[model samples]
Target: MASNFSRQEPWNLSQENLQEWFQDNVEEGSRSFAVESNKSMDDLVRFLHNMPDMKTKGPKAKPVKVKEVRKGGSIEKGTFYKDGSDLDCVVVLNGIPKLKANTKTGKYRRGHLKPLVEKVVTALQQASFTARCEKVSNLQLKVYAKQETGGILEIDILFTGNNLDYNYIDDEVTMQRILSTPYNTMLNMPPKSQRFIYQPCLTPLQTEFVKSQPGNVKSLIRLVKYWKAEYLHQRQTEKLINSYTLELITIYVYEEEMGSPDRFDLGEGFKRVLSLLAYKLGGFQHYWDNFYSDETAQRGMKLKDMMKRPILLDPADPSDNVLQRWKKGLGTISEIARETLQTPLLRSIHVN
Candidate 1:
């Protein structure tokens, strides 16, 4: 039977459709700053203000505010359904540093960042919860945990020191500088795309994963754009948006296998991110249930040891279900997903 998919309101990629997508999803009782983020901007602000290092006006101290950027953009939702879903959020910053590049290394390295994050980690510790802060993405520390109020929050505390020179009141100058910053400088990926990369956002990591396989980024981008649009169209419940995003990342990261020693040789912490995101998300089951390709499931459970999870997938035809269809048609989807799935886990999932 031919697919009976109908391109509807939230699933359309046209501007009109995007407006509606934003209206239906974002404008109508949206808790964006809440859902997309694990933590609160306000909490982040307060924590920083209390930082012992930033408390005084000395040779190396600066203050920052919650830099909120609430705007609209589209999401990858695909087929008859591309996507038009937009997003809005407050991009808050803790402390903006005032570091001028040294004559040698240009931008200061770890030596400059340690003091800043250490103070950040210390203040976050006082939150009356079990929180830990560690350097993860570039200059950002992945700090997170559950608080006393039973709220789960994760944050990317960045030590940009990018725009801390409060001496200027000129918006144009500041905006210009902010724009010129390096791509990897402080979870840097916004100000343009309709889709936010950090959250439901397609990332460089995902882009890299896709590079090795079938469909081009445009096609894959379209698929993800529609996933959020259509999924939101169906369910607008709590955290559904975030869930969709995580699923998007999961799908994008799916790969074949990860036993290769070359895994560590990938660009810029690619190996670590592959392992961390996979395990943190949901282990093998995360990819299996959410992003699993029929091939993985069909890796031959009939082999006794391997075939334990036979491929219920229509071996002859892979493109069936939308998600499944993507998996089969676009080999890259599974390739990335497998790399993410087969990460070296501290504890491999068991099926007893």
Candidate 2:
């Protein structure tokens, strides 16, 4: 593990040696993990992707059918960590009416997603995988399969209406509509529910937002993820910041410090990221304009009343403040970030 290098007087190493250390220790490990995990992960994705459309009864709505299964999360974005990696699958259902907004409050109706989730679970069980359902703001089905290496691979399935028709990547109008529709009307719902409801629909854009970054940027993201997993022990608790938030933060730091340079010092970039988290995370707030302009995003933020500390809006979906759910862990994360910045391995790496 790269953590072993920190104990061996890393601060004494020169800048060139520090870069080499990061390359050999961090980048190589991430590459090796991806190589070793690719085959099994690929097989699972193929299996799910090839599954036939399932016909199942909806509890109250008409009989729904599986419209499509889309890939999401780190697997789709290519920033998965070595220690803990899971697949995020979005199951799009047909025949279910689009989520209706309350005429009075304009908030989208809840409790309608569970039936679709239950059907997805039944389909997974029939396909020879152990499946279970749970509700955390939205409906999710966890499907388990045994890997060839004697480990279990867990895939989280989220159900949504057939809302993937729009080309959100290229169509700004579609992006605006999707983000502004339910989100602008419903500011009073819990943050988690607000984000989770439209997550499946926005998965493609989210994957594209991360996947379209430069290779080096993705490498930096992987490095940050490795650090989070091994040093911060973030995998031990769900309350900690998520990998997506970390990826966006890394991208933000890299872009701010290094700009569009062909090549930059990963060590310096990492130090800057740690510095931000360690010293300035208490009031961290950032968003991107990939799908919408900054002015539009600011309006949406105001509409949503996203005034909390450590706010990071999802680039694909401006309505989502990705870090809202992880507030409880911010103090611990800030403390760890501070300690990590002072570590011998990183203390020598400084940024302007």
Candidate 3:
């Protein structure tokens, strides 16, 4: 394992106090937030499942199934930001009407995708917990709700089965197999296409990859996410950075710069990641072979916007650059990173 602490000045605190600070601030705070938010997520999941629009009435009718709220929102990742936390929930709609089969091609016409997503939106708007429906997309709907404790909760309900009739319930295995397929075979088109067509199908794989990461790495990720949230609050600017971008960078720092996730000083480890951001860490790209290949990642890398300074490849979907949207804000983020280093404790972060 390679370490990057050689040039940095050492902290004055002993190891015991550093560990105590992390536990009180990052770890305990994150767990507490998850506990409260999860109760609301459970209630909301039940409300959505019981909606008339979500019900199926026929011999083939089955109970509506809601996938677990995986990734950052889950307790495992502890990724709640200070001002607001985004919870991602994946739901599979059963007994949805299939598109009219094309007589000429004998393939299912997928024109019903939009209507189904709209249907979901309408149902959620009518649901009791939803304060307002914020945004609706082709595959997901974003809604806002006020927590009983006076916090704001933003939920993104992803209909995994709704993308152009590529229903997961119908053929999951075949769709998932494509994630591991060669990059060229998956997309034969020009490399400039930015659409992550296979994102929905690969959700499970993404969740699992994050879940299986070492515990220490997850802690480091949560700490960086907390810092980024504070960084934005101080500037009071538009939301330029996504939590996922920092999560990947944290992983890179731990794997490449900090030697190993198994052993490290928590405060020093965090400072190292912040230092990387302060310096605009770039040049090398990273990918995991858990779901894709190096050759495939190399090919998929062509689609990313090279003009962007730092490129962090999505672990599950190599063709997508998770950091692309945050490119313009790198300079500000670097400055913020420096400011965070001077503080002994990161503050004003709300978990709810």
Candidate achieving the largest lDDT = 2
lDDT of 3 by residue, 194-306 (tens): 23333554555555556666877877777666655655444546776776667767777887777664777666777788778777456546666555666666766665343
Relative to the unseen true structure, what is the C-alpha lDDT of residue 200 in candidate 3, on a scale of 0 to 100?
Answer: 55
Name the lDDT value of residue 252 in candidate 2.
87
lDDT of 1 by residue, 1-352 (tens): 0011223433223322343444455444233433433234345545555444343234655554434322212221111121233321223244543322222222333334445555555666767543665655434566565544555555444444333222222243453343223212312222222111122111212222323333222233333434334442333322232322333342344343323233322211232333434343322322222222333333322223211211222211111111322222223333333443332221132211
Ranking by TM-score: 2, 3, 1
Give the local distance difference test score of model 3.
0.57
CA lDDT of each prediction against the hidden true structure:
0.33, 0.66, 0.57
Candidate 2 lands at a TM-score of 0.81
| Candidate achieving the largest TM-score | 2
Any runs in candidate 1 off by more than 4 Å, and if so which?
Answer: 1-9, 12-22, 32-39, 54-102, 129-132, 145-151, 162-352
Which candidate model has the greater TM-score, 2 or 3?
2
| Per-structure clash totals for the candidates | 27, 0, 0
Error at 26, model 2, angstroms: 4.0
